[model samples]
Target: MIPQSHPKLHRSEFTLGVLAGGSGIRAGRRDKGLMIAKGRTLLERTLERYGKGFEEVVTCCRDNAWFYSRFSSRVLCDVEPGQGPLQGLSALLAATQTQYLAVIPCDQYSLPLDWFERLSSALSSTVIGVFATDGGTHTPCCVLHRDVHSQVNALLKQGKRSLMALYECEGLAHMAVPGAGMDIDHTDALHGVIRKPPQ
Candidate 1:
């Protein structure tokens, strides 16, 4: 977009992949992304955030395949099935050609728009993923260079899937992003943390 077309959207070279699928044991099986938050559904607010970032936003929501149709391009189904967020990330890498890939959890109450730029500027190469950390624990919510696809594919090929394992690579950079690492795992847990996102 020419920025003027959508002044609220931020333009970036990275493709923002939002991971929104998985049985919602936390949200009581009511499709966590679609669960009413504040007033707007989490899904709606998430698409808007990413829509402003990359040229496109691809959502990996298995249950809500059509949920993103309301938005423009940038949303697509994950090519692989039954795999967790790691698999979803792997699938995302497989479909993208951008030099950088960002994986986001759609359940967050709010995320900073400058997130991709901050993480990208910190890491020098695609060999590592820039993760959000606190204390010293690596938060799986992160962004990585496109170069990890080969390693990620191999892991999925072996029937092994987990977001944390992808960071075991030699040059992975796990840095903390202040409060960006917090996630809304359950409604009660989300209670006073995130703002009422726009619908």
Candidate 2:
């Protein structure tokens, strides 16, 4: 249950964006979102786990837009190709039509079940965004108020493509969740093995 101290945000005000724009050099150039994990595509697992209660779900990808479109309400391509997740994030931010946007990488399948809830609950009128962290910050797994769009655009204009830069610029709060934020960056991770974060 959500604490009463925070404003009760309805799911209708939120849109979920799955980041899938990586070049996938670690996954043999395949679309990481489409890779199989525990008998389901990473994309499928993501939607099944976090798709409920969002106003809509969209995917940002550099390729396979048609395949991603089949699973999401809309599919977006990165605004600048090969620039990395920051470009994809910029596109997602521009495309979001809801008051709030929540993002998760398609390859991170073991995120906390309450991931969205935890992030959303942490958001107040003053707190523009919240992201998950175990020890290191998971910048992509975040919920942002629509008002942050201008900030993101400014960062992009300055060629600040790093997510951590955006995190610090926005003063985003962190929600610590153990055993969360690990992503399948290698081919071996597809076979049900959990990758340990760097110590």
- Predicted candidate 2 versus true structure: per-residue lDDT over 1-199, tens digit per residue: 9654767776678999999999899888988988876677888877877677887888999898899999989999876677877787778888899888988888876676777877788898678888788778465888988777887788878988887777787556778865466777788877653332222
Task: Estimate the TM-score for candidate 1.
Answer: 0.79
lDDT, residue 174, candidate 2: 75
Candidate 2 Cα misplacement greater than 4 A, ranges: 1-5, 193-199
**Residue lDDT tens for model 1, 1-199:** 5332212222476777777766677667656777765687766666656346577666767676777555534556755556776777776777676766777777665556666656666665333667766556555567776777787888777777765676676667776665565566678865644454323
Residue 71 in candidate 2, Cα distance off native in Å: 0.8
Native-vs-model 1 lDDT? 0.64
> Candidates' TM-scores?
0.79, 0.89
Best-matching candidate per TM-score? 2
